[model samples]
Target: MRSAVTGTAVILAVGALVTAAMTTATASASPPAGPAKADPPRPVLVDCTWHKNVRPADFILACGDGNSRLIGLHWSQWGPHGATATGVNMVNDCDPYCAAGRFHAYPVTVRLDGPKPWKKDPSVEHYTRMSLTYTGARPDAFKAVMIYPLWD
Candidate 1:
């Protein structure tokens, strides 16, 4: 009768240990707190029509549409590798001259963001967003959102 009690106690102790282990394992398998991470957005490609072989008087971006143009740019630095220029943008401000409109010069700073993708064509490259931090001297009615990359 003593041996039978001892065997039963051992079985009960083993079952208790197994239950504790399973509880610990289940807790450990639970997902972590907070939201899951999402993938970052891809880099947008520069418009194909905006390519330039020669830097314009003002850096001209010949977009696919004839409406948009960067008419004049005086580059302090320019090359096949990279270039930086400061000039006025002769943009078609949908104002008095919608059709044969007068292109006005707005103060601008132009820069080369990185190296040219195409090796054969040295002058062509990418650019960054315009810094319109200008206060009083800034263009009239120029919105921060309206600014885009004037290419290299």
Candidate 2:
């Protein structure tokens, strides 16, 4: 009688352990509820160049590079009243191909020309120049987003 009781207890214990293990595994294996969302794309860097020149009655800021595959331009006119002008252009180079096998480099240049009174000398015009250099790796899985101040 004692042997029978021990055998039954062992069987019950084994069954319970097996059931618990199966339940835990099934819960874990099931997929999560929500749909998977992909991450946003990243930006890539190409060749670029810029310059600023002060001319009478206006300021000329120019930037460009033959090596860059993609090029963009922007400008703003600062005077008594705030006025702005902007433009973008994409150019593809033939050499030093992009990672995606595209023969294009991103290039950007800007030129701002306008009349503004110098802060120090009200009689003289002030010509201010500014430029930007972007450096980063291109994303493999996502498309790049190129943004410029003039885009807005």
TM-score versus the correct structure, for each prediction: 0.41, 0.22
Q: What's the lDDT for all of these models?
A: 0.52, 0.38
Clashing pairs in 2: 69-91, 69-105, 70-105, 70-107, 71-107
Could you tell me how far off, in angstroms, the CA of residue 137 lies in candidate 1 after the best superposition? 4.9
Give the worst 10-residue stretch by lDDT in candidate 1: 39-48
Worst 10 residues of 2 by lDDT: 41-50
- Candidate 2 TM-score to native: 0.22
Clashes of 2: 5
**lDDT score, residue 88, model 1?**
54
Error of 1 at 87 (Å): 1.3
Candidate 1: count of backbone clashes, pairs at least 3 residues apart or interchain:
8
Return the lDDT, model 1, position 14.
100
The whole-model C-alpha lDDT of candidate 1 against the native structure comes to: 0.52
